[model samples]
Structures are given as C-alpha cells and as structure tokens.
Target: MSVSAYKRVQRDLESPRSVERRIFNRITADLETWGAAYDRAESKADRLSALKGSLQLALVDNTRLWSLLRRDLSQPENALPPELRAAIISISYTVDRITADLMSGAGTVAALVGINRPFIDGLAGISGAEG
Candidate 1:
C-alpha cells in the first residue's frame, strides 16, 4: 500500500475513543445476547457457552484495538484530545500489564477479557451462577 493509505489506517487506529467505542459496542452486544440466551437457557453449559462466547469476542476486540494502539503510538502524531490521550496512555499501561502477567504465567485468558469484569460477573449472576 502507499504511504498515504497506510497513514490513513494509522490515523483511524489512533483515535482511542473510536476504538474503545467499537470495543464497547461489541461487548454490549455480547452481553445482550448472553443475557437473552441465559434467560432461555436449556442447560448450564448453554449459559456458560454464551458467556464464553462473549468473553472470546471481548478478548478479540480489545486485543486487536490495543495492538493497534501499540502500533499507533510509535508513529508521528497530530494534536489529540486530552481525554483521548489519557485513555490511550491508560490502555497502553493496561496492555503492558496484561502482557507481563501472561508472560509470567500469573494470569489466564479469562482474566484478560476487558475492563468490565464486574459487569460481566453481574451478567453471569443473572444467568444463575458463574459456571
């Protein structure tokens, strides 16, 4: 690809709020689907499966986004919103922390889903149990 096209992709990726919003939307949809599935669940594994699916999507979306941020931070920059900058820094720290934890074998994939663990837990509770 041309430099301009690549830079355009980087610019899109650099928008922390946009990336975060997309991730949040994915998680929200997952939660909604999981909730519905839970209420209509035919088995405990069915509910757990929905939750697991949610977790998988949450991990996929956030990790891809954070990877983009890691790449974007190394590039040239224009003015960014203060809140967005802070969010990016926080996200960078979080990604680094999670990576370190994984490398150290101190965490599992279940522990690295997203920032809304409490929300997920609550959803799980509503489903019946943690399973």
Candidate 2:
C-alpha cells in the first residue's frame, strides 16, 4: 500500500474507540483466565497466590481502562452527560477500593468476579451498539 494508505490504516487501528474496544476485550479475557485459575487452584496457598496475581493483573488493566474513559470524559467535545461521567468516576473509586481490599487479602475471588461482570456486559453493549 501507499504511505498515505498505510498511515490511514494505522490511524484507524489507533482510534479512540478501537483502543477502548481492545482494552475492554483484554480485560474480559484476563478476568476469564483469572476465574479459571482461581477455580482450579488445589490448595489454600496456591489458591491465594493465584488469586493475588489474578487480582493484580485485573486491577492494572481495569485502572488503565478507567484512565482512558476519564481522559475521554474530560475532553471538551465529549458528548456524554455529566451524570454519566460522574458515575464513571465513582466506579473508578470503587475499583481502587476493591484493588486495595484484594491486595490486602480482605476481598474474595467471588467479589472480583462479580465486579467484572458488569464491565464485561457494558463493553459488550458498546460493541453491539457500534456494530
């Protein structure tokens, strides 16, 4: 392809929506892997270790996703309502608490899984709506 054409392709791949979708998909996949690892662990130590690592990965990815959403919401041209933006911010705070709790061994695998389900659903809805 021509240079311009190649640049266009790159731009399309890096578009905000495309980036968001990729992040969302990755988060979903990571959560699934974490769930499986948590479920298959055979001993208490193994289970705790698995859960800890899984929670760390999920928390990092979740943080990245929310940071992007916050950036978008902060843009002057963003069309999403103020309430929606506020809700997203609120959820980010909750994620922080959840991450801290999980890291401190005060949270459960089931709670992490429960928290991720709604995000997965929301991502799916966005994908469906865009498609």
Give per-candidate clash totals.
0, 0
> Candidate 2, which ten residues in sequence have the lowest lDDT sum?
122-131
If scored against the real structure, what TM-score would every candidate get? Answer: 0.36, 0.63
Q: Which lDDT values do the candidates have, in the order given?
A: 0.54, 0.67
> Candidate 1: where is the Cα deviation over 4 Å?
1-20, 28-54, 81-87, 95-131
Colliding pairs, model 2 = none
CA lDDT, candidate 1, residue 126: 34
Error of 2 at 107 (Å): 2.2
lDDT per residue for candidate 2 within 46-76, as digits (tens), equals: 6567766665677677767777777778787
lDDT tens digits by residue: candidate 1, 1-131:
99999978987776555445545556556534444544455655654564455544554555665666556654557366666666765766785676454333333344444444433443344332543
